[model samples]
Target: MLRVAVDRDGGVTLDDVADATREIDRVLEESDVMGELPFTLEVTSRGVDRPLTLPRHWRRNEDRLVKITLVEGGEVTGRIVASTEESATLDVDGDTREVLYADVAKALVQIEFNRKKKQNDSEDA
Candidate 1:
């Protein structure tokens, strides 16, 4: 069995994995290869935490909050200040600015919306 997930841009989320698994299943069904190999396939997005280096990645996440980890071990959290195919700039620590993507090792969108209510509820409780 193979499962597939389509992204906002209509990109194949896990096409390679799904396709390969399906092909193996087909061959096993047809030829009885390796005494009936059982297989399962799942395809899905990288979730909301996908990297934001590609221009398409940033476009899919416009207006969202993101966290960027610099190669130098510094971290910057900001609303995706601005993005391009080449790099992304971040508004960090209020007024501080960082051009992150070019030198970043990792970048992920932060789940900020849910955190606010959780914080408020904890305080009220």
Candidate 2:
């Protein structure tokens, strides 16, 4: 299945997914990119299980707890404090650690069902 994940400043709704699917279908029908291939599409919002790979991904996950695997084989578990294009600052056991994007091999948001929602920015799937 072709998965289309989308997010917004507030949140994504069912209608948003339906609208996005329709728009994608319309665009593909107007173009020859698929070359008569019949394909099924599944549109979804970003899931917490998805790894944090890009600067925007890191930015989107600010304040969430994460487990990061370093390129040098080090592992870090911390709550995201701040993030930029090049690095992320995490609060690791009361100590703040700064990690460069290049040093991160993989990063995934940790699940915390009892976690309090920060302002209006709660990470959603």
Candidate 3:
């Protein structure tokens, strides 16, 4: 089975992953020469460590922390301030803002507070 992920209405919600995975499974079963059979499948949202390169990925992570590298060689690490079809606005410092897009050499979701807390708990335990 092929993996799939889709974010309808601009949100990478769990339902989005589920729907895409289901549809992909259906198509594969109907189209593939092999008859339908159980196969390993994994469908989930972008992880806390996932990179946000495409516009759809950015849309899914509208208000999360991210590190962005512009094609011009500038680097930005901050919260995702806003997003559009062409670019993403980031709140770098308290007042600074940078708009970047596919020209980005790299972009990744920054680890969040909750995730960090969980890590700490696991370590302590």
Candidate 4:
């Protein structure tokens, strides 16, 4: 079994996955890279559980909530406002904080099921 993770700035869509799968399949079929071995190809997007280790990962996750564990032994949860090659600016509890990528041991995107609902509710009122 093979897994392919497709990622983008906004997010990965069904079309994106389909296109990538098709292209990869075409390439493999043309090259016979598997050498007659039966295998399965699975194309997917980067999951929320995936850790943010690269500058591009942080940049692509802008406006999303994340929980970061510092190398020094502490954790911080916030929404990513902006990111650069060296660091990320996050909005934590209405305050903006900058955290260096080197200082981050691990960072994972947080899932919010009702965040949009809450925003819409506030807008309606």
| Error in Å for residue 62 of model 2 | 0.9
Report every candidate's CA lDDT: 0.64, 0.86, 0.70, 0.91
Compared with the true structure, what per-residue lDDT tens digits does model 3 show for residues 1-125? 54544444345666677787887767766786545566776676556576776777877786677887778897788877677888887777676575757588889887665644434456643
**Against the true structure, what is each candidate's TM-score?**
0.54, 0.68, 0.63, 0.83
On residues 1-125, what C-alpha lDDT tens digit does candidate 2 reach at each position? 57789976334588988999899989888988878778888889887888988888888778789999999998999998898889999999999999998999999999998977667765774
Tell me the tens digit of each residue's lDDT in model 4 across 32-103: 778899889999998778899999899889889999999999999999999999999999999999999999
**Clash total of candidate 1:** 0
lDDT measured at residue 124 in model 1 versus the true structure, 0 to 100: 47
Residue pairs of candidate 3 with colliding backbone atoms: none
Q: Global lDDT for candidate 4?
A: 0.91
The C-alpha stretches of model 1 lying farther than 4 A from their native spots are 9-45, 93-100, 114-125
What is the C-alpha lDDT profile of model 1 across 5-92, one tens digit per residue?
Answer: 5456423445555675577657667775445556564556647866766777865675567877889888777765566677665656
Model 1 lDDT on a 0 to 1 scale: 0.64
Regarding TM-score, does 1 or 4 come out ahead? Answer: 4
Best-to-worst ranking by lDDT: 4, 2, 3, 1
The numbered model that scores best in lDDT is 4
Worst 10 residues of 1 by lDDT: 4-13
Q: After TM-score superposition, what is the CA distance of residue 92 in candidate 4 from its true location, in Å?
A: 1.0
Count of residue pairs whose backbone atoms collide, per candidate: 0, 0, 0, 0
